[model samples]
Target: MIGNGTAVEINARKGIFFEVFLVFLKLGLTSFGGPVAHLGYFRSEIVEKRKWLSESNYADIVALCQFLPGPASSQVGIAIGMSRGEWRGALAAWTAFTLPSARALYLFAQAMAAASGGSSGGWLHGLKVAAVAVVALAILGMARTLTPDRIRASVAAMAMVAAFVLPSAWGQIGGIVLGALFGMTFLKGDMPSAAAALPLAISRRVGAVLLFTFFALLLGLPLIAAMLKSRDLALFDTFYRVGALVFGGGHVVLPLLKAEVVPHFVSENDFLTGYGAAEAVPGPLFTFAAYIGSAVGGWKAAVVCTVAIFLSSFLIVLSALPFWNDLRNHPSARAALNGANAAVVGLLLAAFYDPVWSAGITNRTDFALRIAASLLLFCWKTPPWLVVMLCGVAGQVFM
Candidate 1:
């Protein structure tokens, strides 16, 4: 009964979904260097190579995801998938991208549960150091392309200073908001018209329903769990809230997860061990939830917790995409996005200095090693996975 146009759209959507799944599955296996570096990889693969979206559109997506309270890079991927094939594409992207790391961490958690201790080796430190180099290169590349004008450059610099001074989630949020405001005032002149809007499968009505569900669970889950006194429900509620509320994802989720899980459900040692192991993996740091869950209640609990943590985030994105598709076409929205994009560069730069650089670069020898890794990545154009392997081996041998 479907018209030819409708049937063609359906077929195209299915094709796009499969394509997105394969691409992200490949990335999930190989994309290293944490969330910031994942953004870089996405830029290279989706924006530069595949030409799925323009550089400006990609940056706009990054800025929007950064503004949201979830895994920024993963959320960006979801948005990319949504643009390509709507809600189904978003789910495919998330699944393909998240599955490899989630499975690895889950298996690791099971192994650690069987063993006495978890992995805490010099090689792990090397992976963290490699993350530093990767983020540094990303900052350099994004700054060059995103902050071309002095006005935008100033916005980035100011955002960096704000993030450095505050050094928290709120600071990052403030920086992005300030950038949008600054862009509206200073960067607004002669702005180009917005790009053509992408098609989304979900309607505004459906998006609204999903959004309402997101808030309903956020507010109602705790009350219901309290009434029932169910520990399982409580656990899901806690992680779901964490996914819903935290900004500056990846490492930023650490403190929140620690506060919620440690000493109450799992030991501090186990939690820290899992966190360290998460660094060596190649996908979103949120997968640490699986490890923590396994330590607490085995594989079933691991699946439960991982799904709980990621679900709210997916819901929020699905809810927002339909609306964002329209809002992004407005001139003021485009201007604000320009400022937000510059701020994203600054945010990554600050992240590089604090957690990435400060944590990884401890000594002159570490400094030299990181510099070498940076050269391999930026100048020599080495593969990231290879660089990660080499640096990890070097860390095991030297450090």
Candidate 2:
């Protein structure tokens, strides 16, 4: 590793583990505005300023992570860390970049739980309202980007309708699968040439083994947990499955989580409050998992849930790294991704309407506040965290 006053250059063998850790640690503390904003921070600090990787390299990693399940920004950080210091770098990068928000959310959940006692408060309602605006904004922006063409838009709409009909986790998964099939059947079209292939340290053989482990855990954990009747294992399985299946990003993960946790492990009010509170935090929105974990079973659950949620990103990213180029070049695979992306929008739409809109907007006052927050998000282009904070305060004052 060497630094030219302007930038830091890291290679495979140098002692850059700590440097990489610190850079991402700073980002974890300061990188707000959700995943897209997180990506911008990574590009500015790691790419343009630090010179750790090229623009194309970052873009390629972003593309691959977006295709895979889990948090794309965190995975991008892990991938860049891998390039710098192999597994050690990846571990360091993920820890530093993820830990800050995770810890903050865990503490916040604990604080809210302690303060609220047995009764819900106006602030909780405020947070729920914040979720209303944030998710609405997310759906609109994602639809514009992911479901741009008519076919994909239709896929999104149908997926939303199906989710409404089923109203469960199975519905969300089914929607994604159907969208993929639809895209493969109808959306295949022109393709851009593939980006330069990433140079990976993991061999094809190791990738295969890790890939097998990923599937084995995915398929077997549920059975193992069921046979043993262990709630801990069951919790882990729920989060792991969610991490593996979620397609669009963090916002889409909300509905899947609602299906899994609400009315069982966590209450409806707690869930929405956490969802709204998550919008106010920095780093990847996925740290919202930490809040859920803490709510159910304290710090232990917090650690376990956090690991379960993110473990797939490590296994799948490394496992798929060796084979990504071949897959990326195939038109069929790309078309399926297009369909899945559209379905992701639908899933968000479904989630927004039910748990988000329905729970948050109970009265005329709540509805008016949500509209104002949405306008702040859309027309004024206010930062999300600020909008969320203002909503919380408004919920306290007005309703």
Candidate 3:
């Protein structure tokens, strides 16, 4: 019933913004188990209980955000906030949902920095090993979902090769580009049937402007950072770019982040250590940026990185809201997304080999720990936070 090519009636009301903030903050504090679980929690809280939107409407929002880069759960929260209380609602939702995890990780980073031998500590190594298991599990699950056919499998394989050959952020970006090209050429399919239109408050013009701004910053930030040689600007650019380019949410950002930050902004141990600790937190995995930024330049850097990364998500979800009604029906868009997702699997695989597998498995004990962690993750279907704890204990005692 919300179908249209124009703005929906504003539902803005007094206290609605604060209401949205409170709801999301509650979710932030309790919604653990990664992005997928976060989605389920949202659907229950917003759609089922609160009755914010119909089932089909929520599905459409999720569908749109899932295809775009950045954390899908956070984007969905923003979209709902916008639909309910306009832009202020969107801001409230994002702030509340992200604050818990970001604050937790920032504190963790400070502690690690304060610890004298923290980098070489068994707990940190266990975190690294946890990252190994997590990434390995991510690739397997994603490959099954994203690389189902021979063509997509080949795309993933080629992406892995590209990541290895180039061995940098460019390589990862190239693989995504390559996947889009291959998808357009070979993965073409019939156009999708249209779905219920979202109750978007943004106009196509505003969405277009935001979309352009998103790309402009994406393209211009790096040049500006390089020209001015400003490390802070460069830091913002790196996190923003990673948030913009990641196809699959959550674990897909691992390799791209590792490529950019490892040895430059943060060491490999601190990187994985943060990632593993992120698993234990109760919000978006993108908050991992806060920890890395803290390690690089303290809380101010943490604030910059966190803002820069999530800002992309806000821009993208807002931009796409007005366009999704048409874009989601295009067969080519879907195909390109498929190819990009396949490339993500390949990227994860490459990450597994280098920083994940290579660094985590230094000896027979570590190798055995990897297998046990994998089993706990895959066969046991254990929660990742639990896995992190178990692995940390094992790494402390055995490793």
Q: Rank the candidates by lDDT, best first.
A: 3, 2, 1
Q: Which lDDT tens digits does candidate 3 get at residues 323-386?
A: 8988888888888888888888898889889888888888888878888989999999998888
- Per-residue alpha-carbon lDDT of candidate 1 for residues 215-281, written as tens digits (9 for 90 to 100): 9999998899889987778779878987886656776665456556756788655665566567667
Query: How accurate locally is residue 214 in candidate 1, as Cα lDDT from 0 to 100?
Result: 95
- TM-score for each model: 0.68, 0.94, 0.94
Model 1 lDDT on a 0 to 1 scale: 0.77
Task: Compute the lDDT for candidate 2.
Answer: 0.86
Counting clashing residue pairs in each candidate, in order, gives 0, 0, 0
> What ranges in model 2 sit over 4 Å off?
1-14
Candidate 3 local accuracy as lDDT?
Answer: 0.88
lDDT on C-alpha atoms for all candidate structures: 0.77, 0.86, 0.88
List candidate 1 segments past 4 Å from native.
1-93, 109-119, 189-199, 214-305
Worst 10 residues of 3 by lDDT: 3-12
